[model samples]
Target: MCGGPSAVVQVVHVTSLRINNYGYLERMVPASPSTWMATFTRVVAQAAAGFRRSRRLFHPWGECFAGTITLLVPGTLGIREEYPCLVRLSKGLGFVGAVPDALGLAIRIERPQPWDVLMVSSAGTGVLGRLIITPSALWTRPCYSTLMPYQRADGELMWLHARALGGHTVSVRRNALTEAIKGAPLGFELLSGASNGAVHWVGELTLERTAEPGLSFDPGVNQVEYLRLYPGWLTAIRSSAYLGSRQSRGATLSD
Candidate 1:
């Protein structure tokens, strides 16, 4: 139930807890060793206007879109395919306005081993706009950072990149970035390696919006075998952040 609206059937619910909607800060237990989780959860609760399992702290701004995507895995990793996908775009914060916030993208593929990708805005130039999150106009042409180190099959640590391929002519709107996506088809790619080295095209994704509710995306659970999480302090902190967010909202972490 956590990976997307379409993921509802696969949600593995654990024991639950009840929390006071307005007392998130007071009742939230530390999800990790870092003290940042407490402050982060408090800040997010304020932005979201309350504590509830229905929303996220960072990346709370959400819009559903659809497209076709291709996944180009390294031959050594043994994965490659093309599929129809659902995409969600949002600001990585609970701010209620068109103000600057980290932009995020989540793609969910409904295949045998449902794959999910979550990306955050990054700095660069192309048909894709700015990589940093600032109080500029929201455009579909933005590039998002995979924001984590990916472990290749050979145990190499790599980063990922995804740039939007549509909605360049649309204007920014207030309270919603949907205008950046309406009536426009969207697509993106996932690449590994670095410019200084042998870069590899690993995955491609296209997305569309629909009347049907999309599946909820939980990066903690929805993952592919080839694209593995990096091992390090940052990843640990990120896991803590997710745990902190879930605790504040009175939700269980997915298996």
Candidate 2:
């Protein structure tokens, strides 16, 4: 279950990395590369090649929309001001029948240096819930989490989440998401928290599919200095995978 933001706990600048009840940040020592890493790399490379040949590496066929994000209550990261953004919604694997497919919400904040926020559907908003990947058949049902923690300049880890609000509903099948959003606009209440503890209302995201555009979002590259991905090794692997996917497709880094 999700709770409101704490009033007493003073979450200052994200760079300061100080939360009232949260524990101190600890360094994650990297393990020596083993067969595990090699095998994973090989498999990912092969998969990226196949995806590149067919369509894309990650969310292959997605519907893009023009939207805006309003930061109502900037928390630790202190991301203030509203932003004009482009939002993309897609199913991870294109699972058929009753199988639940992981839903993705990719947002490109159109600032001088754009911020790409890629959120995946999560099991819940609690500690354990944020870690577990919860695939959903409905586009508006599940809560999308950043998955990997965003490290603060002061060494604190934070997370961003979005859950559909105001009863905007849609069942995601092969070709359903686009039509649903066309009839009724999709809206989500943005939430931020320490790791996955308790999330507070930070802002709102509203999306509309007026016109479509081909674009790619990279969380590793297009990042602001204030907010960075934590656990260097993990982000390194993610960046490699994204690179392979992009290269095989004969596509350069897109804004």
Whole-model lDDT values for every prediction: 0.57, 0.72
User: How does model 1 score by TM-score?
Assistant: 0.65
lDDT of 2 at 141: 93
Model 1 lDDT per residue over 1-255, tens place: 566576435432211122345643243443435556544653565456545434565665466766777766467465777787777776565455555566677777766777667777766422222234433345455556665656767777666667655445432344244544455545566666542335556777665544233245656456678767776566556656665666555555221
> Which is the leading candidate under lDDT?
2
- Tens-digit lDDT string for candidate 2 (117-209): 999999877888887888898888999998898887778888889999887657776557678777877789998768549787888898866
User: Of the candidates shown, which would achieve the greatest TM-score relative to the real structure?
Assistant: 2
Q: For model 2, where is the 10-residue window of minimal lDDT? A: 14-23
**Model 1, runs deviating above 4 Å:** 1-48, 51-55, 76-80, 94-100, 125-136, 172-182, 195-199, 211-216, 250-255
In order of appearance, the predictions have TM-scores of: 0.65, 0.74
